[model samples]
Target: MNEIESYIPHFIVHGRSRIAQCECASCRAQTPFVTNAWSNQVRHSAQIQCDSVSREVLFERDAFKLHTQPSSPGDGEPLSAWQNNVNQSCINFLIVEDLSIEERLHATGVLLSRLSRDDLNESDASTPQSIGDELLTLAVSGVIRQRFSQMPSIDRYKRDYLRRLAKVHLRVTPDPIASLAFNLKLTELQVMSDGFLEDVLREIESSRQVEAFFGKHGHVWTNYFLHRCFHDVFPGAARNAYDVMFLDLCLDLFCLRSLCAFLADSDVELTEESVSALFSAWHRGGKECLGRDDHVDPLLVGYSLITRKDDRYGGCHER
Candidate 1:
């Protein structure tokens, strides 16, 4: 390792222990990333060879997991295997819930490690499913929609969704943040000096304003949610199947831990005419413009394509 190699990981600003140690985009390629927010933020990186042949190199000089039981599969692996199986898993699960289906499919390698029923129904029903796989299953099952039912309180789902959503977007610019504030009617305080938000999800204070706001900023909300998701779940245990793959569900489960939280953390709910507009826009691939209405039910996805959609939100406009 060289002096430059040592400094690559330091460039990764926002991840918890879930952050990986590859130094791929950061060091070798000099990809820019934010560590803090303003003054402290600077560019940093490292690089590793990716085999075009895609071979696995391994050394077995250590006894890593001979005797350890930290409880659930989400507890994580024994040593430094966190990056590949864990971080990517969480990233993929969030992609399905957040970005355009195109982006999700595009980054399929970094995220979107799916598992099948035969994989889940394997001989190990004794353990809980992989959080990643489970989340994909949740997406497929549409179970997340239940949280959006006619709950007495609205903010329950709203705040949780916003909080998680904001973290995932990695939004540090004034324009997008202001745009978010304009749409959501939520306050946009500088949680991180350079317009980065971590601790406090700046939200506006009008429930009635959300419908219109959601219409225009669905992608914005999706970005925030996926960005925040990086912080919500961590490297715990390595999972077996897609259903339990990445501890990804913990964040959504974390979002829905309680009744009020469930109510507060509704799916990014989009309506019929709204979805038609979005689908049309999607079909056009941003070439042409549709109504500025882009919204998702304040939501979550994976497993069976059947279970991935929610019943509470059944209406949509055709493309």
Candidate 2:
């Protein structure tokens, strides 16, 4: 066999073994072996084929490490029990709740920097829709929201960094609930696009795996969205009315009613008349805008249709 051809199997073996090792030092050492093997194989000749092979092997080795290595704890700190139990890639995500906003953003940046194209591919292979949900969850947690908003305004560099990281995470991870959660949180941070919210709705409408994910986590998702909308998205400001409308269309009847009740309980200026008008507009757009059938709350679907009919007939309604 040619030198490059002979080294391919050894490179693959070492690469796979390095991926399987959870220890930091062992994994780091094994990575160089794969790189050095390729370098040695191509040392005698600078042929195009040998150069291409070297590039491919090194890319694969980097991707493998990116997907498998856990975030190392800070100096003097040890890995938590939860970190040890979960997949290495998820260690930082699992600990996000305990971190301050600054620390959380730093951790998020570290995690994002480690993600590779191979990790996205692997996520797609395992779960097409909920890919990277755990990491997305960390980005949108209650602690993140509270801390992010309470802090003074972000500088341009940090704002740009967060915006880019959030965009990349959304592009690679297609989890519908995570998309909503992250979009709302990022919107509060003033680092998100209106187009992203629309894209998230489209993802929910198109992915069957998202339907299943919603069935299991629907309540939690609804609660997160509701809390954010009341506290951040719709604070009775004139400029926020448009955001309120956007969120209204995104929600179904149950969540819409919950939002209305929340607004009523608070001193918000959103009246029942305004909410009803928003729902009417949403219903006029039909199911395509409403999202996938299974992703919609079953109770909301039936009740919303009934409410629409009642509204059309001018019947007295209390919703």
User: In lDDT terms, which candidate is top?
Assistant: 2
Whole-model lDDT, model 2: 0.30
Cα lDDT tens digits, model 2, 1-319, are 2222121232234444433442332233333232212211211111111222222232332212121222222233332222222223333332333332223333233233333223333223233113335545645565444433333431232223224223221210134554355344433433455555444323323334423323333232222222222222221223213222322322343333332332232333332233333222223232223333332232222222212111111111111
lDDT of 1 at 73: 21
Best by TM-score: 1
Off-target runs (Cα >4 Å) in candidate 1 are 1-79, 97-129, 147-206, 230-319
- Residues 181-287 of candidate 1 have per-residue lDDT tens digits of 33242223213333232222222222223324343444432332333333222333333333332223322222211211111223323332222222222222221
Q: Which ten residues in a row have the lowest lDDT in candidate 1?
A: 52-61
Candidate 1 achieves a global lDDT of: 0.28
